[model samples]
Target: MMKRIPIALYFLLAGLCAAAQPKKLDIVFIGNSITQGGGLQHPLEEAPPVKAWEWLKRAMPGSNIQYSNQGVSGSTTVDFLPATNKLFNNVVKAADAFKADKDATLVFSMVLGTNDSAIEGPNGSPVSPEQYRLNVKAILDQLLSSYPGCIIILHHPTWYSPNTHNGARYLAEGLARLQSYFPVLDAIVAGYRSTHPGQVYTGYTGGFSYFKKHPELFIQENGRSGVFQLHPNAKGAAELGVFWAQAIKKVVGRLK
Candidate 1:
């Protein structure tokens, strides 16, 4: 029995050494109000404090991770394109500190294009479907060029409430429904994946199909018909944040 003590101690020490190595992870989330956290069914409901990245961090305890929420409410893809914001300098330099750490695995998630289709107020103007594609491509090309090894995931935009009375779906071009342009995202990302192969992927969050079946989960406010539902309330956020995190975890797992 005494002789076996040394052998057991050796194995225990090895396990400790292996467990001491920390995994490095970095994530960046980009989009508009939906991505940032907005839209509630009730006028009295408060915003959900936890977002997708925060929920993800909570999910994985004792892991080395760096994350940032770059979501800007009421902003369109044009805000991210050239002649607008300095995505690399602002996003990478300001928000993404992990970019400095060469050893860290980087993941970028984009949930945009909703505001691009807005027709309300002075700022609202729907972008042409083709232009939207080009803007997205520009965003990707810049990111990949900066971090050649980074992993990219395109999140499908959330579904708009069918109730047209609220007028949030007001269109700047085309037949009027702003959500129709969403499918262009799939096409653009699909082409991106084909050329980039394993480095890029599309994380289908089922936003459109989901809310359609479970409209109760969405916030319905404004207008007698109650048509404003481009955002999810606290309950919606929790469900969505969790679902998206699952997709993110899958991609993060492939980092090694």
Candidate 2:
């Protein structure tokens, strides 16, 4: 006959088991048109945020996930600046809602700078690389203060045709400016390593170069300048979603 285990010991063992399980995730995606699935048939269902959440579900079985899409058309980093209280307020509300889930880990996945690089049209078009870095840092500072312990992932914005000119004018010069922001993002993440430690990370650096090589993945639009590729097609959105999910998983796994 086996001896009975003490009640206290039994409860401790159960607690240990629960602690070893995967933690639930609550993500807030902040970006611009591409993130919102601007050219997609049904943005509500086909948006990159939705796709990323779907991919994460399959990739991390048994983990509960929730997300909010805060992408706005024609939005720039300046639009998300803390002083604006425009887009940033909405982002706060979304993150606060997720706070109700005490068991879930909060994460902010951001992709901006597309419209910021535009020569015109966007609110803060032609934003210099220095201003762009400051804007992003300010946004992150407010977010960190508002939601302590939340993870922040800054992604490199994807590519658009050199001739991209519709509501906004992003010619070859604009594309070059967009590329300049990449190094700024890298520096920002590096700075956070010392200040915020593991709370901040650089995410999905491949999109810019990857999309540049595959024009087929993007939808060709009849712009003022002519045909141009900006937003990704459905297949591209799915792939982009996978890219985000991979980066998120890497960060979370590292912390785990």
Candidate 3:
């Protein structure tokens, strides 16, 4: 026979539960050319990356959040793993400078696979769907293994290239296939998180939906007639940033 807990004590315990939750996110943006924020003219030159940072900063201004961009121009899913490995090694060397301080939660925003769809290999070999999926999984696994309890947000690659003929369709199809594989990644991460409990894995596919709704925003200059460029323009980047921010915010809320 247990004694009944007082209502005031229950309220005090609830407050303590909320207080014990984690705070302070340290997010790393890792990806290809789009993440590098390329091709926007002066004044708008930093628009792409800046837009993303601004959104995050606004959301958690006082959360001790730190955002780092590890994007590289012309990178694909296959190229990114090596790049991150090098960065993580450097971070390990400069542990004080690179490692997240206490109270910091790690998060990774990844957008890749577009270049793999566009470019052919040395022997003109296109990256097969299976290879693309494997590359994505390797990247996620590496990050999760390195940073225990890290939160990963896997984004679908955005569209570029006009008329759907010049490689856009190929990339779009690759993204679709990538989306199908995300549940597998989620399941893997979910199992890992159950043991590691603090880890989080979330995904969202907003690329196709946004492009289908806002075609005009991504139009590229073509002397007289505008066309779609392989990379997003200023307006397009802002739109992409908004989609990213909203999706990330939702994930953050759920995790919290």
Best by lDDT: 2
By descending TM-score, how would the candidates be arranged? 2, 1, 3
Q: Please give each candidate's TM-score.
A: 0.75, 0.91, 0.71
Most accurate candidate by TM-score: 2
Tens digits of per-residue lDDT for model 3 on 1-256?
9999999999998776544433676667776657667666632345455576677677655555566666666666656553556444432333234354766766777776566664333111245666766766676667667766677786767655433233224334544453454455456456656565645455557675667666676545442223545567778877777777667666776665
lDDT of each: 0.66, 0.92, 0.60
lDDT of candidate 2 vs native? 0.92
The runs of at least 3 residues in candidate 2 whose Cα sits more than 4 Å from the true structure, single-residue gaps closed, are 1-22
In candidate 2 the C-alpha lDDT for residue 69 amounts to 95
Which parts of model 1 have CA positions greater than 4 angstroms off? Answer: 1-22, 39-49, 58-62, 86-89, 120-124, 164-183, 223-227
Clashing pairs in 2: none
Give stretches of model 3 more than 4 Å off: 1-22, 42-47, 83-98, 119-125, 162-200, 219-226
For residue 171, what is the lDDT in candidate 1?
28
Output the better candidate (1/2) by lDDT.
Answer: 2
